[model samples]
Target: MALDRTKDSGNNSSQATGNWKPIGCEEKRAAVHVEMERVNKLPANSSYATHRLRVLNKVLHLISIQRTASQNEELELLFAGISL
Candidate 1:
């Protein structure tokens, strides 16, 4: 199953080489943990908490789409110099 494969890949990090963590991964993860704690302390039924949850979701979405400068350069090298 797709879910099993996903879990396997996540659990088997040693199989992957190089810089597995994305740029700023630790910082972003720490920020998310802080935000989650803050969110958890908010009243469950409050509109402010709802708003914060939505904002957090958006922030996570943006972070997922973000690429590092080195990744961009690698992509350029892959495409820009190709003669085919």
Candidate 2:
């Protein structure tokens, strides 16, 4: 009633062992820890924390500008010089 193809096929190899942990588990945990530490180190009402927030705002603004620039025609001109 059942078919036994194992004897018909001469190969007897087994699959290799795979990773036990999910991918990027450690990296995600480290990133969360670092963010938590950064948040804990800065006092809510301190001048230093206010200055750091301003700097981070500037950095985010620049990153948004860079992203917009990358989508423009200048990036096409930049890539024009390179040959595949």
Which prediction has the highest TM-score against the true structure?
1
Residue pairs in steric clash, candidate 1?
none
Q: Write the per-residue lDDT of candidate 1 for residues 24-50, one digit (tens) a residue.
A: 645664676578678879999999878
Q: So what's the TM-score on candidate 1?
A: 0.44
- Per-residue accuracy of model 2 over 4-82 as CA lDDT, tens digit each: 5444433332212322443243443354345445755878888866765554444334334544654444433322322
What ranges in model 1 sit over 4 Å off? 1-25, 66-84
Top model by lDDT, which number?
Answer: 1
lDDT against the true structure, per candidate, is 0.57, 0.44
